[model samples]
Target: MKASVTDKLKILADAAKYDVSCASSGSKRNNKNKGLGNATGMGICHSYTEDGRCVSLLKILLTNHCIYDCAYCVSRKSNDIKRVAFTVEEVVDLTINFYRRNYIEGLFLSSGIFKNADYTNERLIRIAKKLRNEHNFNGYIHLKIIPGASPEVMREAGVYADRLSVNLEIPSERSLQKIAPEKDHKSVYTPMNWLKEQIAENREDSRKFRKTPMFAPGGQSTQMVVGATPETDHHILNLSASLYKEQLLKRVYYSGYIPISEDERLPALKQAPLIRENRLYQADWLYRFYGFEVNEIIDETQPNLDLEIDPKLGYALRHLDQFPVDVNRAPYEMILRVPGIGVKTAQLIVKSRKYGRVRYEDIKKMGAAMNRAKYFIEISGRPLPAASAVPERIRHEIIYPAKKAQLTLF
Candidate 1:
């Protein structure tokens, strides 16, 4: 007996949960000239806007019938699971109906390799083309480019999709071979390199010719599974940095490996490494926004992040000599390195301090996390009492404030 569309949606959507690279920012497609929808500055998968507007996406997999038996994946071919696929028309109908009803702002579509990479990729491209040309749907579309897919099909995908991604499931080539032997670095990088060039060329062409179509206007992103392999956080972060620098990747998502299968080859984790995943995100943010290098966050001695504290805080604690940054006089870059001072707050401090010295109360008003920042910042040329500058004491106070206060009073 064949399943209905609703049943297929249920199965595939649930199967798609493991994929966490569905953000839809950085695209600016308008519903001009009477299109079905707009994707201007919108985010996907329930991501929020600046004013707290939550945008939702109909995130789903086209199918879960993969051909490869990756040891870490729930949809490995050897696993006995219910298999289903959505016809291209079914997906198109669903997107149009969902858009009319305002159920979703956009679509995020990925798929398990059904037969071969090119075959599966062609089907995905057809769906996007139908949505764009046939229906004039201008909504955000994020498509996952299948590894080993032909460059011709990938170029067609780039023409219609707002964003594209290829998941590097394992962090390193060695681990990738151990878990997913069928895949290799070349298969992944070849498509990624092609997409990067196409995106760049399309931008140049669009500037010269107004009628030129955009290629992955929101840029490309990739995901790496954390804790599944023996790769340290240092290794993962360095890889992320290289992707951002070399491939010009927009984002690198880190999914803490969830133990879905009971394979002896995989780790027997009680739960996903959610904390480490979050810490990596923090470290990544520092790299992208907070002007941090990969080595600065984690080094030879400390390859793993402190799961208890954030990377920024850990960095500040390790380099206490750079602390007590003069909020009234320090450079913008130095102020941004403060553990509790965010980019916005640091900018505000720089702007506000031009007229006069910034006070502790002013720092609080600017939204710096004073609890953490107090020990690291100076106000009115008065640093935190010299006793508080001690790294051990500050760490104790930050980690266990109540205990420290009790000890101080006694």
Candidate 2:
């Protein structure tokens, strides 16, 4: 007997959990009242199927048969996992039905590489094209741009997708070969470059056409698998930094590599390290928005981030001679690098300090993280946590590694 639509949704959504880009909060677009579009910043919540995972969209694979036997993927051909594919109409019906019932915001459609990259991407694009042009359904569509897919297909996919992504899958090409061997690094990055170009071109067109059509209004993003290989935190952040700088990516998601594929080449971790992924993200943030370079954030001297200390504090300690920034007198750039002060707090400090000298107590009012900030800031006539009187022993107690050797200059 054939399973019902809910049965397929259960299997597919469980499979889709491996993808990290499904968090539906980053971009916002709305649904038309009578039509099938709705993106309220929050994607649909109550469409829970058999799995306890939140139902954001009708997430599913276009096909499960793959050409690549990536050693780290459950969908690898060598793995004996159950396989399934939704016919284009079946997917269309499932999405339309799910939307009508208010189950999903849009479709996050991906696939295991079947036949070829172009063939796989074509099927994925067909779903988006049908959703937009044929059905006029315009919720959030996040389509995967299968690496090695032709530029023309990428252009078509971009036209319909709210966002497009090509998973980097592994941190280094060396690891990629060790695991996802059939996958090409050029294939992955080339399409990323293509989508970025298309988005830029589309943005330019919209600027001139005013009422011109929108192409991927949400922008492009990619994923990097963490701990799957011997790649360090520094290595991961460096790759992300390069992606952000050159590819003009919106976000780079980090997934802790789960040993879903039972390849002997893969690590047998007790559990995936979410903390490692989190630290990479923090480092990536510092690189992108915080105006820190990859070299400054992590380097040959310290090839990996201190697992215990936040990167901001780590930087401050390494560059200790620059510390004790005067809250009332320091420049904004100097204030921002303080261990406990974020960009927001730094802005607030500068803004309020202009009128009158800000006090230590007032610093916390602006949302500075007092515990770490207190060690580095002095405000008004009152010093923070009495920085002026803080003995060297106290500062040493807080910093990392407890090295008895003398601290060297940067």
Candidate 3:
């Protein structure tokens, strides 16, 4: 039986919730010629998760009728589920109408492979074109570039999409083969490389000529499914570091694998590995912004992250010899390694110290978490906690202060 658009919307929208890379930042497409919407660099906001991720986009799959029977995927061909797809015009109408009502700030379109790579990719491109040309939508549009598609079709896709992404899915190629036999790493990397070249070339041309069109102005990003396979956190972080360095990817999202159906190849998790996924993101942040290396976060000895403590706190606890840092004299980089001091707070401390000696009160007012920072930092005339200052004691105190206090009373 044929399903109505509302029925298709319910199924497709629910399916799209698994993708966590729909953040609408880093793109600034201003509306011209009195267009409908615009994507500002600040961000688009309609809904948010508990973690504060933006969910303003009309994120949905173009179709769920995939040819491949990936063991991890819900929409795989072998699954007993209703199948439906939207016509090209139907998608355009939804975007236009939804934007007018302020229900969505943009569109995030991905699809399960329908027939072949090119055939599926072309339909995605047509929908984006009609929105831009016919309806004049200048808002953000992020497209999932289909792997194994021709370079010509992908290049045209880059011209219209504000951002492009290709999900690596599994951390290792061997794991990918075991799970999704029909896909490979090469098929994914091929389109990514082409987009990188195009985006770079377009930038050069735009600088030389004022009217050069932007190509994926928000740049390219990729996502990896965590906990689906046996890859450790160390392996995952190393792969992510390489992608940021080699491919020049803007973001690498970590999606905790959700068990759809029981497959021998998959793990038997009661729920998604949400906590581990969050820890990886924190570790990734330390690598990208906090000037830490992958080895510093977790090495071959301790492959997985400490499920209880964050990666930053874990580092601080491991290297207690480097603590008792004097914020007044320490360099900005050293201050950043502190457990409670964030990037902003560290910068403020550096700037404020140059004017005068930054006391304990000053740092507290600057928003440094005194509960954690007080133990690690040495402020003038303010002594650190003399009791339980060792690594084991500090870890226990920070993680369980109430228990530590009860013992101290004895």
Q: Give the distance in Å from residue 142's predicted Cα in candidate 2 to where it truly belongs.
A: 0.4
Model 1: which residue pairs collide?
none
55-166 per-residue lDDT for model 1 (tens digits)? 4777788999999989988888988999999999999999999988877877889998988999998888899999999999998899999889788898889989999998
- TM-score list, all predictions: 0.95, 0.86, 0.96
Worst 10 residues of 3 by lDDT: 380-389
TM-score of 2: 0.86
Candidate 3's TM-score: 0.96
lDDT of 2 by residue, 133-215 (tens): 77878688889888888988888887788888888989888889887778879989888888888888988998888877777
Candidate lDDT values, in order: 0.88, 0.79, 0.88
- Kindly list the per-residue Cα lDDT of model 3 for residues 307-374, writing each as its tens digit: 98889989988888788788998899999999999999999999988899998789999999887888
Residue-level error in angstroms, candidate 2, position 82 = 1.2
After superposing candidate 1 on the true structure, give the runs of residues whose Cα lies further than 4 Å from its correct spot: 42-55, 408-410
| Winner of 1 and 2 under lDDT | 1
Please give the ranking of all candidate structures by lDDT, highest first, separated by commas.
3, 1, 2
Q: Predicted candidate 3: what Cα RMSD to the true structure?
A: 1.7
